[model samples]
Target chain A: MSTTEAGGRIAIEVTVNGTRHRREVEPRLLLVQLLREDLRLTGTHIGCDTTYCGACTVIVDGEPVKSCTMLAVQADGAEILTVEGLARDGELHPLQRAFSENHGLQCGYCTPGMLMSAHALLARNPDPDRKQIRKGIQGNLCRCTGYHNIIAAIDAAAAAMREGK
Target chain B: MYPAPFRYHRAATVEEAIARLVEIGEGARALAGGQTLLVWLKMRFDEPTDLVDIGRLPGLRDIEQEAGRVRIGALATHARIARAPLARQIPIVGDCASGIADNQVRSRGTIGGSLAAGDPSCDWPVLLTTLDAEVHCRGPSGTRTLPADGFVQDLYATRLEHGELVTGVSFALPGKGSAGAYVGFKRCAPAFPTSSVGVQLTLNGDDCTEARIALGSAGLTTIRAKAAEAELRGRTLGAGVIAKAAAAAAAAAEPVADQRGSPAFKRSLIDALVKRGVEVARRRARGETVEVSHEYY
Candidate 1:
């Protein structure tokens, strides 16, 4: 079997949100770049090359992942969900609404990752305490809001989600 | 930034992965969850010519409990192991997994990869050493099992040869009255453990029959606190005995100063964490409920 060269492009198949996408990408293409450049889904922001900042966070198969750190080939044949796909049928996700209403975001650069991280938290735990909420967003770094409103937003969203169910 | 150029091969089976490793020889690296390797790649620390992706390999993602021991496959993600029924039943493994980096890291990191990477700061090495775990590796020469202590040779180094893949790790189940705990201290943000201690104690009618203490981030590798274990062997679980054992454990640690913490601070932290770990284990063994103070996410 002939192997693709290092700098050559290779075919990649990945499911973003619920849509399947097939594209040829460079071997060095990051999952973040693939989502932003190839697919034109820019909800996943890239803040730092280091994994410290969770600005490029996304849900891959029910788990929150740092998209910048993972290569596009690594995500081949995997299910990915970005922040843009959170809302359904023109309605905002409860977390999104909570962030807006509770002033969870300031500059909004970290909101997408924060929302995605919180979505994973709510999926695992519909009702999380303040400590849990803090732990959930520990990977996401927010410079503007100081995380006070973010924590409150998650708490309120949890309550809203529980009430809705 | 993107990683340096490298050929990628997704192996469908363990045999295929091993074969690919053999083919690629020294220029190949196995990809488990890519939590650490990807970071290193992006930083241009080390570039491999080929990446043997083992994420799809079968039979390397389960947690099995046998007659005498529990077996954890190498590809088992930390998240999966954290939620594994057998791990929760065992408790120590679950606690250790739960205490790893954070939700994002745990979700994408694998126990096998972490242990194989042989980082002294990781949680599994310390806990596995304390539990006397055995690491099973598969190579061209067939399969072999090495005791966890012998498996890790030094910092970021293992006894594993080229083309060898860690298949699984096995450890004996804790006895009826045995309990264990992993305690550590970390600074703000990301919450990497500055100094961590793993303690396991087996009790017989309020007296400790066996005790094992392992300290991580205290040296080139996790060190067993033999003197501390000896101190607690015949003594009843109490604050005084715990303090003595903790002091011995701290004295045994030989840590270096790093940005996360200082040598003196880490040495002091060893004692505090070991004391806390032993107290927590003893309390749990006595069926007493106590809140554990953990700062890490």
Candidate 2:
């Protein structure tokens, strides 16, 4: 939980998806590294290590944050959700299915971050308009310029989710 | 990108954080949301040996409205502030908070961290200066309050001492007949504004009784356009007078040429932003709902 002092390394516990993990980590470790390397949750891709690109976006304690800019030590005792946690029981989540149907991705480098961002947005506002959807995913940049399809997929997911599909 | 190795100390209280900073000397830095600090660390811009984790400091993330003033705790995230009831009551606060960076960054960036970073391009300093907010800081010695206008001494510098931390910021609520707007021009959601303006006007019918204008990304520090404010005070907010005030604000700015724009280009942006800010503030003062924010092209 809360650490006062621990020399070069510190003990941290975090709940990711539905699993709890405990590890002793160097404070310099980035959260992206924790997810991709330590936990082997490779679904969260790292595009620009800088904060500008939201390729490493994840939901931490209910809000979307850029994992590239967050330290693993900073995420102590928090709940995290990555792209790997989206599907359930071998069934694709509504957003994932919508993305497939709407041709929401091209190179797919930005898919995970876009999915998480759109998921957070839909969680807050189940019926975001086109402009709102655009604002919701503004942090995520797709190099393939597949934003049009991505927005449509988010819209489709919202509608399907609202109808209990 | 891995940050250089640093010892992490989680402070349980404000006094403890200050003590750790004091003990660790200049090599210690206080970490909050880490939206800016971590980026700097990753870039190897500044390598500190110790970090005081103040992210979980109690009673430092509260947003409370008291009597005639609103107080925002240092750890209040931009996302939280953007949706707070206070922001709805004060449109300028919402404009600044909601228009900063993007969703992911806003979800993690704190108002205090933005102010503490002392970046001229940061929106909180400009908006707080327009509201005449006071920064509350606690240090090893004692506590003090500083005006937001002069809090940032220069580029990436602040009045905060080695062992001091900002506890919160408070500003008197704008009285009736007063409203303000924060407007900026940026290339995209994540990019910093090329130039931004914050204008708070107290309008009595058509006559402007008082005006406060602060320019961001137009100088090394947030610049208070006193000459422009002088032009607006006690004058009818006619088109000609507003233009003159905008011109004065453009003249007051000292923007450096960077990838954002040329000096002349930024000056022109400052002029146009001031006018837009004034116009939106005027409309909002008249009880009309005007949605204004950083305009991106």
Instruction: Report fnat in order of the candidates.
Output: 0.58, 0.73
Runs in model 1 lying further than 4 Å from the true structure: A1-3, B289-294
Task: List A-chain TM-scores for all predictions.
Answer: 0.96, 0.95
Q: For residues B11-46, could you state the per-residue lDDT of candidate 1 as single tens digits?
A: 887888888899889999988988888888999887
True contact recovery of candidate 2: 0.73
Per-residue lDDT of B1-297 in model 2, one digit per residue for the tens?
A: 567788888899998889989998999999999988998999899998889999999999999989999999999999999999988999999999999999999998999999999899999999999999999999988999999999999999999999899999999999999999999999988889999999999999879999999999999999999999999999999999999999999999999999999999999999999999999999999999998888886
* Best-performing candidate as measured by DockQ: 2
TM-score of chain B taken alone, every candidate: 0.95, 0.99
Looking at candidate 2, what is the lDDT of residue B71?
98
- Give DockQ per model, in order: 0.60, 0.64
lDDT for predicted candidate 1 compared with the true structure? 0.85
The regions of model 2 sitting more than 4 angstroms off are A1-7
lDDT of 1 by residue, A78-116 (tens): 999999898999999999999999999999999999999
